[model samples]
Target: MFNQRSSPDKLMRIGNILITPLLVIMAVVGCTPQPRSVDVTTNPTPTKLVPDMRATTTVIPPTETLTPLPPITLDARVAEIEALMTTYEQMDLFSGAVLVAEGGEIIYEKAIGYANREWSILNTLDTRFRVASLSKQFTKILVLQLVEEGKLSLNGTIDLYLPDYTGPGADQITIDHLLKHRSGIVGEPAVQNLERIERDYYTQEKMLELISGFELLFEPGTQWTYSNFGYYLLGVNIERVSGRTYADLMQERICVPAGLTDTFPEVTSDIIERRASGYWFDAERGFIHDSPLDMSFVFGYGHLISTVRDLYLFDIALREGKLLNSSNTNAIYEAEFRPIGDETCEAYVVEDGPASINGFRASSHSYIREDRFVVIVENVRSGGYYLPGVFEVGRNIAAILYGCPYDQPPPHVGD
Candidate 1:
């Protein structure tokens, strides 16, 4: 029985998934101010990747086939995802980047339309985008690492580390609960003070204070709710146990082993050579160009950025057990489901599945599956509201990749 009301903190805003200009600009400045040494390890393992090229620079003559696979052969699945991009781009509905991977191979990779409309900066396969909630997976891995090291225990109460925290359920909430969104913590009120301050520019200490004071929404471990606050606290726990910053942990454990050069925890302004600019749309504000919200509060939960290629590679690594141990991995996946609805209604399933990675339109935005994963990224800010579309885009791509029918639909991810 999943608990419908077991909402985690809202610290994770939607913008984390897609990098907005606001976030990029703020990330650039925020990272600059905090200077820290990052550890870089060299892994001799080499990957069998197709020659990497910028989609923006590559000229696929209009008459040239749009196949992104080997020997220029087109698979029906790849063709459909390509066609969907064409249709969506024509409708002016989507303009970002996407990649679909199966068995650790790129079945399809593309960047459509404009990354930046003004300078005519085209989107590219290497161009970076904010992966909003996608960052949570990284956060979860860090916490699991701490658990493996014996610095923290999943069942250990939160009070073990932060003796001063007096928030409701502080004594009862465990590290496992926080990771699974079962902590029952009501997440936003702690930030009322920083609400006046811009999220990106705020100091880390202030952000912690905001989270430390939130009240409990339900008894610890009662149900599951997607709470950014729970994740943010997990970040704090990492800092406490590792005696290092969150950014440092990410680079050392995840990025280096995966060989993801374009992905990083902080954002900087002087756009990387192949970075895309994000745009927002509104009724009154037709197209507002902005950076991703600088969320110091939810820094660990959703403050990372990466390109589609790197995102795909990282997902593959995690699924293959390159990151965490088997027990921790199982625990991490198990934390996803929280029982919801009444007896007559079905309990919400929270397992990571193939459906979660499908672009934006799909409903379970945060889910990641075992075999195939699709990442649909968008650039337009107004496009943020179309996250569900991103999921659907992934789903459509998945259908083609797995030889499954998109219209036929598969099992519910949560179920």
Candidate 2:
């Protein structure tokens, strides 16, 4: 049965899955003062426990009159990004692809580093990488589509759809709770012991069985917790109600209609062209192969793979109401602003960006009101040779586009 109230300790456990060790590094390093020039190719490496030199130094005045810089045009913005990316490449902090768009047209697009590092195969705009939790947005859209069609109800309980399932608070957990990650279900259990179980493929039934046996972390709707289990179950509910598999339904409803050729459920065994090989970094071992997992285990939660261009199409489609009506689309954005786990939702949320997994990280910004968007997808992990923080990479690009003050990535010591 669902608990009516949540304990403080339980509420504190709602950690965001998207936050990676790299973000921790950034938090500790903190932000530096923005430089006068945009050239980031020569920024000094960060050092630990540096004394406050700013307090001790005397101010100096220039003899000549300072000239104010000219306003940057759209073409200049593209060139600035290219220069920034070149600096990142030299620093060994970035690899993969980036695409920026405005008013439904691509303004700038570029690819850096190798897709298959072993073969030295260069990454291109077509190089597909796992979008990780960005897949959740797609899943959310599918569920909303069903709601619009009257095939599913947002307030409907899990038991109403999957009566045979016996998860805790099955009757009390509503579709809204699952979509918002307030269902109290735990998801990290499936990720643990990956080394032992990843070799074998898991069917939806097998994954569900594993998730259902676990007790609720908190009562449904009492507290927000990001749960892969919640989304997976929602996927199952979609399957049960629509009488179709998650993949088939996504194809028929979302992908086909949007003309998303590159976006689809990842099938590990099948030969996928232009798929970037995943890589992770270790202090002791340097860049290492990302541990493999059966794609089936990540169904509806994270399995979709795509390129930047395909994702851009998705953004445009959503903005133009190709998938859902204007009312439903607005509702989706409203739901997005409702707090997720411990994090407070942004007041004027304009984008859904940043999805990180083991070896790959993806982020896209659709400034719908501003009529501009940015997409950055990296195939390298942080703490590697020169890889920058994933969130920082996205932030820098956005700053450049908006002509806001921005700091270059602090140099990693080893690099």
Number of the top-ranking candidate, with lDDT as the measure: 2
lDDT of 1: 0.55
**What TM-score does each of the candidates earn?**
0.69, 0.78
On TM-score, the candidate that comes out on top is 2
Predictions in order: lDDT: 0.55, 0.67
The per-candidate count of clashes, in order, stands at 56, 2
- Candidate 2 residue lDDT tens string, 100-135: 765455667778777887887778878999888788
After superposition, candidate 1 runs with Cα above 4 Å error: 1-47, 50-74, 188-200, 267-273, 290-292, 333-370, 383-388, 402-415
lDDT of candidate model 2 versus the reference: 0.67
Q: What C-alpha lDDT, on a 0 to 100 scale, does residue 393 get in candidate 1?
A: 62
Model 2, residue 216: C-alpha shift (Å): 0.9
